[model samples]
Target: MELLYSNILPLGCDDDERTIVGCFKEQMKNSDRVEIAVGYTSNASLNELDALIDRYAIKKICLTIGMYYIEGMPERSYHTALRVNQHWKASGIGEIRIVKPFKYHGKLFCFYKNEKPFSAIIGSANLGVIKLEATNRRQYEISALTINETEVAEIAFHIEQLKTSICSGNISDIKGMPLIRETNTSLDGIELVTAVPQSSVEFYKNCKTYVSFFLKLKVPRSVDRHIDDGKHYTKSNINVCYAAPRNKRKSRDWYETQLTVGSDIYRMEGYPNKNEPFFVVTDDGYWFKAHTTSDNNKQFSAVGDELIMGRWLKGRLVAAGIVKHVNDTALDADRLGMITEEMLEEYGCDSLLFKKTGQTALDEKGTDLDVWMLSFVSGNDYER
Candidate 1:
């Protein structure tokens, strides 16, 4: 038996061999499969595991997450889990499941060779600990590795039991599970609300003093012809914002959502200046830091994060049954076809509206900025 502590050395000085990530990498050298049962996890952790699986040529990895069943998963994590599950399904790698009926808040990792359990790590570290950039605060996790045949087999058997049909279900099976609201706690002592308010009428009435602008989603005839040709404009204009070049090394599937503003729209005086980020509270209650980038400040994007804004817009379309949820196996052209002018028209809205809410909020950096409101409701009230 060997005890492992993640914070034995200073943060930067801690080498791979001194951390849980290092320990897992070492075990993977001789293992063909791994089983993980943890209370909680994040997309970043799954990404790390995905990289390790590829590097080690791991045949199979099964994860049974337990926290979502009891506390409810956040909207971001829920969507991410769905996308990753689809990706894994297409690649024939592994699957992620949620333990149900009762919460199982145990953390265990068992490694196997030749279908036999050879070693196991039992500890307090959730999978999130594997992500080096997950947090800035110092954290300490203590775990023990057991090479005893009997102990290793016992742990593996326990994980196998958790994976059974009676105990767990694939992530896709829980689509009806309520998603916990996402909030930003980065602001000093102030949490930014990210859940849509229940009543739209009441919200607008309360904030009567505001300025609004309607953004029509009209594709130029030339651009539409090019898209139809399946050449440079092969992807839907709606998805062009998400079509940025990804880092091949990281294998990231999404990019920071950017909505290109024309010169006419750019004339709006209150919009954030090029590279000057500000806070935006969506009519649906979600809030994110946004900035304008690129030539003529045409690209409007959420600061630092990729998933938030994309999920916000695309999720609504999915919920309305206007388009199918993203599938990893689908061709890029097919995925692009999912969001079209016809779908937006069917949904009763073909544009988005931005409004100045006549309010102010402090961003993550404690910079006081004007808080704007964004909406994509199905209506023509704001139409020119």
Candidate 2:
């Protein structure tokens, strides 16, 4: 389960401070219905919303506007609200309307993942762009997101109720209440973080985004001990050494390491330990703030230099198969036979120690432990 929190927005900073609206675009994916209750809004924010709705694949939208914001913005906020409502109505996409407001100072967004209420944002920021200004000119705002079932259900119902009570005009191609599901563990998914080479942007945008946590991790230092005489980093570095962060990068890291299967010790130039847990694939993601023994942050910068995960037979880590109904435990070779025949053949060898368990060799520290029972993806189907 991933819990993402946005840093408070100030001013004069674009990339550093996480925009509440911008982050919303990334969080809602494969969406069903999107609803926003904004105390104040504008055309710029609406244009950005239009792009976000398309990019995030939102099916339905609800905008609950507060008309009584500034004593009575009959000319300003009210007129703008009516104008915005017309745009949403013309699009043939969703429902929008003005609502009663006397100190209704709240900005909230609730949306679904797949067919259920999956995530929500409840915060102080409006659905409009904040101006970049110095200290005194900035209005401090903070908000919190909820993936929790009980809270999302309440928020969803609130949006729905607001629409029913005040929305005189409704706009929707799909005429119904938004899809809401009783919370289930299976519906949970993480926000994907990735880095694609500039040269491969189109390729990755189409093929590699989402599906897996893709990043470039360095080769295991123990690769030398696994293979007898063959030094993968020094010997077969060309095939394995790929540009990370992006294909345009000048310096590349040797990411691939040799694997041993049995007494025969199978080692191939391009073959990977397909069953490897992503924990062993690499230590850090495209960008990460690691936990210290204390609270200081450690960020890993633009270091993506390899293909990670995507469609079956077409990615660095190809979709192998899923192991459904397995108890949550650290993944190991003992559990390989339970998942799929392909998994057993591809990475079921005794050679797997760290990759299967997502830990270092005999790691008592348990740094990378995870509950195992999700779909598995790998480089090749059956050891290529």
Report the number of the highest-TM-score candidate. Answer: 1
Residue lDDT tens for model 2, 75-162: 2223234445556667776756555424455677888766588888887777663332343234555567778899998988887777
Residues 110-164, candidate 1: write the lDDT tens digits: 9999888899999988988788553723677878889999999899999999999
Off-target runs (Cα >4 Å) in candidate 2 are 1-19, 67-70, 74-83, 101-103, 129-137, 166-384
TM-score, every prediction: 0.56, 0.37
Report clashes for each candidate as comma-separated counts.
1, 8
lDDT of each: 0.68, 0.40
Clashing pairs in 1: 196-284
Q: For model 1, what is the error of residue 200's alpha carbon versus the real structure, in angstroms, after optimal superposition?
A: 10
Q: In candidate 2, which residue pairs get closer than 3 Å at backbone N, Cα or C atoms, i.e. clash?
A: 94-171, 197-246, 243-305, 244-304, 244-305, 245-304, 245-305, 318-378
- Ten residues in sequence with the least summed lDDT for candidate 2: 288-297
Candidate 2 backbone overlaps, count: 8
- Residue 136 in model 2: shift from native, Å? 10
Q: Which residue segments of model 1 deviate by more than 4 Å?
A: 8-17, 134-137, 181-283, 286-384
